[model samples]
Target: LQQLRSLGQPPRPVTSTACVPRRSKEVPLCPMEQPGETQDAAALPGPTRWPLLGSLLEILWKGGLKKQHDTLAEYHRKYGKIFRMKLGSFDSVHLGSPCLLEALYRTESAHPQRLEIKPWKAYRDYR
Candidate 1:
């Protein structure tokens, strides 16, 4: 309850990393970085991104974050072995191939902190 209450910041909502205002009529404090030469640097194919919100609005349209697992599977079918997604300002690549997974595991740390595994909840509880 305390953790929930402390997260409230009216002027700009507080995310884990940065403060971002909700998608609204108000002008944003910081503009979304226009992908210039950096855009071409990434070679992965993915979802179309709109300015400011990136692919967030599309996620909402597709059925919000709860259905994201299914959505990603659908994307894998559509985009093939690997694809990219931009959520808010964060860009991530999804790997669907076994070879890609094996390659990643080879290069990972001893106790790799990978994304959203079931063990993460247990680890967090242990911590």
Candidate 2:
């Protein structure tokens, strides 16, 4: 470690900067270069959102939790493939397209965790 500093070659700032090994020029990946590439919520489709309650009032008006399925189905019909809505404190984006679901499911193992509740996976696998 001391030898690197002494030789005037400082260690790379971030490991993901490139595919090349030590002493080679770093090739910045697109996402790494422009870090703030997150999807803008304002661009997504959905009903009017109140600051505190978000779209919760709309959900309730449509039929509350009991008819959440119907409300969401209505939302899908109104808002195309993807939409963002907040029910109480949960701010979530719902994807209605099969392609979007496929993409999301493909990345499942990216942050794999132990499944303590077997029924969740069991139900999904059964389908």
Candidate 3:
């Protein structure tokens, strides 16, 4: 098509950054003034996430679902129990410690439900 022809070929070499930008002038990267004070989520260490696809490629590179546990363990050893990961646009935190799990459990409702059940319900309805 004429439109396709008008749009010239892509660049030969694409430039890229190591990680996403943290555009915060007021807040510090890792604020820890008082003793025993917890650091912000942003302050926690994480693997470099590229734009759009984020850390998906990196995760896949290490190995897919089959090796997820091992990959996470490796990351945990490097970045610690709490580290951030971005899969596409969805940002997630990996909490490997018991204390973190306990904190999350305490904050949940008395009868906690699965967050993702729509697909299962839809499949049952279809059946």
Candidate 4:
């Protein structure tokens, strides 16, 4: 009966660690970073992007759908093996190396589910 009655009672007041004062003078950086080295992801170069629309306008300006392969090749030459680009609301990273592709293929699930099947679904419904 006492244990059941305790369940209805409010939680006890707790002291937060944030409220405590630190003895150290220097603040620690992110755990992901080493002492001297910077993050590799931040160093990668890519095209200038606009807010909300991202790099969509820049990609279209290069030649739209007709020259997508050419544009990617141009970017590959400019940005090296790896580059980041955004289209409308979508953001993606492009890898131009065969070794990276092979590694990704080896690591990927055997039965990966396809997310971009709207066109196939539409065709099936129409048929």
Quantify all predictions' global Cα lDDT against the true fold. Answer: 0.56, 0.57, 0.58, 0.55
Residues 1-127 of candidate 2 have per-residue lDDT tens digits of 0111133332334333233345534322121233213345456788878888998888888888889889888888998767778766666777776544443343334343432548767998899
**Which is the leading candidate under lDDT?**
3
Better of 1 and 2 by lDDT: 2
Give me the candidate number with maximum TM-score: 3
Model 1 has an lDDT value of 0.56
- Which runs of model 3 end up more than 4 angstroms from their true locations? 1-36, 107-127
Off by over 4 Å in 4: 1-43, 107-127
Please, what is the TM-score per model? 0.53, 0.54, 0.55, 0.53
Question: Using alpha carbons, what is the TM-score of model 2?
Answer: 0.54
Give Cα distance to truth, residue 60, candidate 2, Å.
1.0
The lDDT ranking, best first, is: 3, 2, 1, 4
lDDT of 4 at 100: 35
Colliding residue pairs in candidate 4: none
Comparing 1 with 3 on TM-score, the higher-scoring candidate is 3
